[model samples]
Target: MNMLNVSSNAFMIAFFLYCGAFIVHAIAVMGRKFSNREPEAHVKKWGRFGLILTLIGLGSQLVYFFTRWAGSGHIPVSNMYEFMTFLSMMVIVAFAILYMIYKTSLLGLFALPITIILMAYAAVFPQEVQPLVPSLKSIWLNIHVTLAALGESFFAVGFAAGLMYLLRTVKFDSSAKVDKRQQKWLEFTLVVIIIVIGFIGTVFAFRASGYEAVFVQQQVTDVDTGGTNDSKIEKVIYHMPPLVAPHNSDTESYTSFLGMKEPLFEAPSWMNGVNAGRKLNTVLWSVISGLLLYGVLRLIIRKPLSRALSPYLADIDPDDLDEISYRAIAIGFPIFTLGALIFAMIWAEIAWGRFWGWDPKEVWALITWLYYSAYLHLRLSKGWQGRNSAWLAVLGFLIVMFTLVGVNLIIAGLHSYAGTE
Candidate 1:
């Protein structure tokens, strides 16, 4: 219990430190002209400060991880909370390594936000230290999951650099067809990121308010025991207000919100997973809150979000950002292959007596691997560079994210144990 408490405190310390690093990095990038200071000197001094803070934050997170491991009598990456937090830590590691190699403050500015958002997202899930399940009891769990996440973290850094490259180079004011199309897509990408932030903010807000809604979900299953049927009753709890009820569920206890005492509608029969309706409701809230946040920002800025932000990136070298992005992805590709594919197959064969299964998780992992493979080929062979390579890197990370998160949430398979409650 003492170790667990210490671990929790260390995690909080790390979170705050990372947030501080982000602000300092942003200052380093954006505050170059302030007080008529020499731009190069200003960036160098503040970028050093940001790097110090980031290193300290990484140290604190390591403390959190090892303490939790000691407290739990096993590695801490066995559950959603631990895995996501671990992923965020790995992202910091990847960012720190790249930042050191390139000495780029803009990389820190973009990458630290991703690390912070992932930490916040991880907090939205349950954080209790649960024992590893039978299948997850192998050493491969550590190798497969950790390496895969480390690889993905590099890919994440690549995404950040790629995005920075786009923001630095794209002609936001141009009305030409190519520039206009690029502007729209870039703004759309920024919107998706803001939506994720909104989702995290909404969850924490409702949680702090102590909101609750409960439902009794009744599911009927067909059995193969000489032609029989079974009815199962389960309770699904919603930490946020219920906007969509399960398909065949009845309200057990309800708290009215905004003059409403019932869900807006029941989920369709096709959405039959235990928490599918709740998941859908959460998605709806995320999109709503995200768009609302974007709208408010638009109103305040009086311009497209990307356009307003483009000037800050004007001094950055788009070519350097592109190079960093490509190098990071190149380094991560083989690590990802080893962890997500080779090690995974070894573990799966040992656990399930098969080397391959068309499970959703497995399929998505394969798809992600193939996509990145294509990306590398295109970059090396057809000489895809600048905007083209940047876009691919950005989109590749999205696919990696879906493989890690979305597949678990939306698809039921052998990896369902990895999903959130």
Candidate 2:
């Protein structure tokens, strides 16, 4: 097989390996209650097995990265699929390093699933190798993207550790106002994560069923030389049924879903984005599917998810969890500053002749940086630790994610080129 084929096969292998590792880690954490098994020994033995599997998966993914780079004749970080996969790989690297340091099975229980979700999310985007656009042709593309993703990966690990700390410590049945509020917000955070997983599931379901819809939007542009408007028609395609149609557009083709042949609503005239309507429809479906999934899980568990999982983590030390979360973010923060801000500005100067344009993506990146900066300040100087620090770590990752995904979907700017078509 060709290197590209080899890369694809290797990627699949890595994904399966990661999945296996997650399952084994789950067993390691949860199987302690089984008959005749000492909890500590069971955890250590199975955690070692899980760690071995994870390392092998990481190695296989590295092969996928290099082979794809070889086959594509450029770095594979040019598009969403490649970048997300690379980010997932880096997350595994970070997780493994933390695992070695802490030797905590609970960390793997959270981290491996996240890595799996990222890999799956990457699959939701187009994976075909595409040539680098003019702006992405610099060596800084390699430096900026890899470093940014690497830093983000450490943040991901921080998020996992922080979340673990919360789950281990949060009082699910508390009657106090402070405790109740934390419960509600933690539940909301879990719901949001489920919603993301729902998005992946919804996309894959319709895509597998061969569902299709198409719209043609006519956009009028102002001309500088001529005293007239120039009209351009853009064709937008959806892999799922549309609940929201594009503004000022006619349906070129559409498939009925649940007896609905037309869009439920039109996108607002002001909502001019790259496939804004389709994206909005996707958001709607994700919310619906995610809620449904959460509901199903709730039914199965018959308790708050936090409560259901908290017992497994009872043996874990909350202070250690807090320390892991803080250390990961502390390591990630400076790297993020260097990559997402410093190298990014240098790249922008070279490509756009300006260092900072206040573009939506750039603005959000700045927002993320400032948010994390505040997080560190509060953590070190203002004495924010334990629950407060965990909350910041969790929320900080959310901001990072919004900067990565939400801005690309909702806003139109110079960085829109980085988004999927």
Candidate 3:
């Protein structure tokens, strides 16, 4: 078999192995409900099985990593699909090491599902390997992005712990007596969930329907020292249906969408680059599609996801969970700063002539960095202990995610390679 196919098979195997591990870990944590005295020895045996499967999954994915490098002649993290898979693999590896230190199956219970979710989310993107663009052909592509993704995987683990802490601690005053703070936190969490579900659902829908839209635009370049080319037609292909049609489609194949007016507001020149308003179109499509999906899911589920998970957590120690949540951010903060900010700056200076541009991606990276730094600072202080620190950790990851995923979808910039699938 060719390297790509072999790598694909390896990824699939790893997915199944991770799923098996998640199920076993979940059972080990909640099996006490099933038996009066679920033997600690039995749970430990099952945990070992889960750990073994996790290691096997890691090994299988390592094969994919090597074969993908051989196939692509570069690291697999040059695009969203590859970077996501690699990022999830890194999370699993980090969790493995942390598990060795903490020796807690509870961490696996919360974290393994994230790896599976990431793998699923990555599958929704364009998986085809392609030649790297001129901008992405630098060695920094591997070094900067590899470190950034690894660092964020730790943040992902922190998110798990943070979420666990909130679920264990946060409670509404009552149905009759609702504390606004608790209500707001719950609402914020649900909105984030909706966005994730919405994005994933829209991607799946487009892929299944084979829906494709093309954006035609004009291009200008300095030809013959001062001449420009406006005659060239740039065709931008989008698998998702357009919710907001672009006004610049010179081609007759243009299909107006959603009763949107002839011309919507235009993005800044830096946003869509040469493709005109395609980035704005994508952002609109994703937002509208996500809202619809979120509404439908809310109607069907009728409860926040945390409520469903709270029962299983009863046996898990709240203090331990809180500590893990704190420890995760504490561990992830320096690593993230080094990779996402420092290495990023060094690479940017090499590639783009400047170390900082306040590009959406760069700004968001800085925001993520500052937020986590504050999280660490507050954590070390006297007052912000359990709930506050957990909230900050969760919020920190949200910004990291926005830096990682949202900026790519909503804004265009030099740092798009890691995300612009």
Candidate 4:
């Protein structure tokens, strides 16, 4: 009967549909390799099916979104959990629109997986709806964030297309003189992806094993009573373990290895957000686990991760991929500017009594905008198209990620409204 329960169920169902779509799209692409006769027709059938499944999934998610909005009595984009979910949902919608224009089944292979990963990542976070703090009670919360997510979702599609372009265009044949720097950058991208997967896997493992602990400093007020408790509540350190726990966190529950905590140095005081320790821990674990994964793969294959992934995308059209990459950003940049910068400033003025503060989030937003501005300027005006433009598009999206995720995780500021919940 509760809204949360109903919305959660719908979200799960939508995720499965997305998973089904991924499988079908994958089959469509793979079928192209096998069915020489009527290959286009064969792939089209499967692609259509995949699109239908994706549309169904999107619809189900929309139902979940509205149901949550009805149940929660607000747009469900407040916390990291809800914001990530909403972003994935927007990614789905954006991908759907792009698929209509490009009609490429291969696009699904990249785009759908991104959404799936985002959905899985979002699911891992605490999903409880929190009462809005004073700043977030305004109508602008939805307008500002929802628009920004929509803009970024389009940029995400550009990232996917840019990635696909790099895979198709970049040489990995070993016979051709490969640029070591290109290989290194590609490997770096793979490591970034591995880090995300690593975080998800480690968190899932901890939760499955019921490995929960208490961080005495986790600032949380009771839901019913705005009263603080004398003793700290039990919280799971899901960011994989803190590389350096605060001196005060050496509790009985804080497990250690060989009578010492890993990276014995204490976390810097500046990292003092509510879940600062956990977020830092998550980053460390992500990097360490990602390196381990990259090392293991390198040992097995004796090649860079990018080279390993290149063959899959080798057959894709370089021009189409490049066009999609360019088009996505061209369409997205204006929307992103209007929403992330303009609407954000308007909301900030209303909420914080200023249009702009040098908040980390605000700074990063400006950086993202400037980076993309240069990207567009180079591509359109300076004739910096092809691999150079693709590279810029790819790098620009990284800036977007830093603005979106890094801001929330590393630096706490007025935009820390998400953490207030």
Best by lDDT: 1
Give the poorly placed runs of model 2, Cα more than 4 Å off. 35-37, 224-228
The sequence of per-residue lDDT tens digits that candidate 3 reaches over residues 1-421 is: 3998999999999999999999998887778567566557667878888899999999999999999899878889888889889989989977887788888787888788789878878887778887887767788877778878877988889888878877776674455444456656756785666666667777787788776666676655556655655446677665655554444454335444456423455445444355446656655666776677767766786865556556777777788877877777777777777778888888888878888888888888888888877777777775688777777778877887778777765566776664365
Scored by CA lDDT, what does every candidate get? 0.91, 0.90, 0.76, 0.80
Q: Mind giving the per-residue lDDT tens digits that candidate 1 earns over 1-421?
A: 9999999999999999999999999999989867385889999999999999999999999999999999998888877788889999999999888887888888998999999999999998888888778999999999999999999999999999999999999997788999999999999999999999999999999999999999999988879878798889989999888889988999999999899979999999988777999999999999999999999999999999989988998888899999999999998899999999999999999999998989999999999999999999999999999999999999999998888788777788888664387
Q: How big is the positional error of residue 222 in model 1, measured in Å on the Cα after superposition?
A: 1.9
**Pairs of colliding residues, candidate 3:** none
Candidate 4 on 1-421: residue-level lDDT in tens? Answer: 3877889999999999999999999889876778878888988999999999999999999989999999888899988888889999999988988898989888888889889988988877778777887888888888888888888888888888888788777777555445666767777887888788877777787677665444545443445565755445444353345566643454446555345555455567666444666666666777777788778888998988788778777667889988898888888888888888999899889988999989999999998888888888888899987788878878887888778777776676777655422
Give lDDT tens digits, candidate 2, residues 33-147: 7737577899889989999999999999999999999999889888878988999999998898888888788788888888999999989988888888899999999999899
CA displacement after TM-score superposition, residue 116 of candidate 1 (Å): 0.2
Ranking the candidates on lDDT from highest down gives 1, 2, 4, 3
Model 3 scores worst on lDDT over the 10 consecutive residues at: 254-263
- Cα misplacement distance, residue 242 of candidate 1 (Å): 1.2
Q: What is the TM-score of each predicted model, taking all chains together? A: 0.97, 0.96, 0.84, 0.89
Task: Indicate the worst ten consecutive residues by lDDT in candidate 1.
Answer: 412-421
- Using alpha carbons, what is the TM-score of model 1? 0.97
Cα displacement (angstroms), candidate 3, residue 298, comes to 4.8
